[model samples]
Target: MVAPPPIIVLAFFCGTSIARSASPGPARPAKPAPIAADARHKQLTFRNRPRVVRSGRMRRMNMSTSQPGTEIGYTWPIRVYYEDTDAGGIVFYANYLKFFERARTEWLRACGVDQHRLAEENDAIFIVRSTAVDYRAPARLDDIVKIISRIERLGRASVDFVQEAWREGTLLATGSVRIGCVDRATLRPAAIPPSVLAALRHGPGTSESAD
Candidate 1:
């Protein structure tokens, strides 16, 4: 065999190396979205997750729900995803409020209370008068939570609720919520509508309605 040229042999050392040795660029992480409480908790502190209740009255995944035939009460299940958490991979404190709101909103829907329509026709909307929440246990990013909502009291112009959050059959958080009817324009106290009040007096029909 003929010997390789000396010049070509020398240039090989300075040429590009094998493609197998190349390095890939680092990967970028996705940005997270801003967190906000759910619409129901706008007037109260609350959240939702998963749970199984024997009564089939519907309970928050992590919360206590109404048993069958409790007047003007309802429960909804919710599952937590990564989007519901913070940097530590746990549900953020504020997020629990969102959860609570969701359950209550659905409860209201169960009550046949249309907030938007009520505001438009009656010129009134409910506002959170007060909310007291206690964090019992920390919930993780993917932890399923149940939110339970019940009407503790219903006045001419306001409703009081006992709301709770649960995870793995344990209480995660609890709160008492008070919401009052207010005039849309003045934001002043207003009496709850008779129709809405009647719906509140009766629990959702056939467990089919939702807020």
Candidate 2:
């Protein structure tokens, strides 16, 4: 029998995470894209880009241009639609998870940790270990939220990421996630690849130690 797929949870947010310098590592600004005037146009509807989940994950192809394994982080811009809110038009409590997750995956992709590649070539997978969250305010439908992903720690077998969600320059929520690399079959922790670790250590983040 096939083993059960590991549980994967998304983390949200972008701001002053881990109190690190914003020098070196992934260099591009870790901020959200400015909303276009036409984002609300009918052409920008879900019909143009259907929301679908693949393998228990959101399918976001090339959401960012940064190469994988060494980005300051990835930025995901999401428009709040009617379906994302309550009768009163405020966004529900949980959709924030969806927003930050897309950003994290893009961050991973920017760092070159393709989920497929890690599984095939290295027999490794990143599993979310824990999440610490704080919800500050309610986001309204149609508001564009930006999720930022940046590293807090690179350890022997795990990496910690601090993410945040913002609406129009205001901090809305924050998340601290610990991700562990594990063996595909044994379900045990495994050391990250030398190349991957090296990239992350040298990649965009406020790394004060030797890089």
Candidate closest to the true structure, highest TM-score:
1
TM-score for each of the candidates: 0.61, 0.60
- How much is 3 displaced in model 1, in angstroms? 99
Q: Least accurate stretch of 10 residues (summed lDDT) in model 2?
A: 58-67
Tens digit of per-residue lDDT, candidate 1, span 120-162: 9999998888776888778886567777777766779977777
Residue 119 in candidate 2, Cα distance off native in Å = 0.3
Instruction: Count clashing residue pairs in model 1.
Output: 21
Alpha-carbon deviation at 145 in model 1, angstroms: 1.1
lDDT of 2 by residue, 78-129 (tens): 8889888987788777777777677777766666657897788999888887
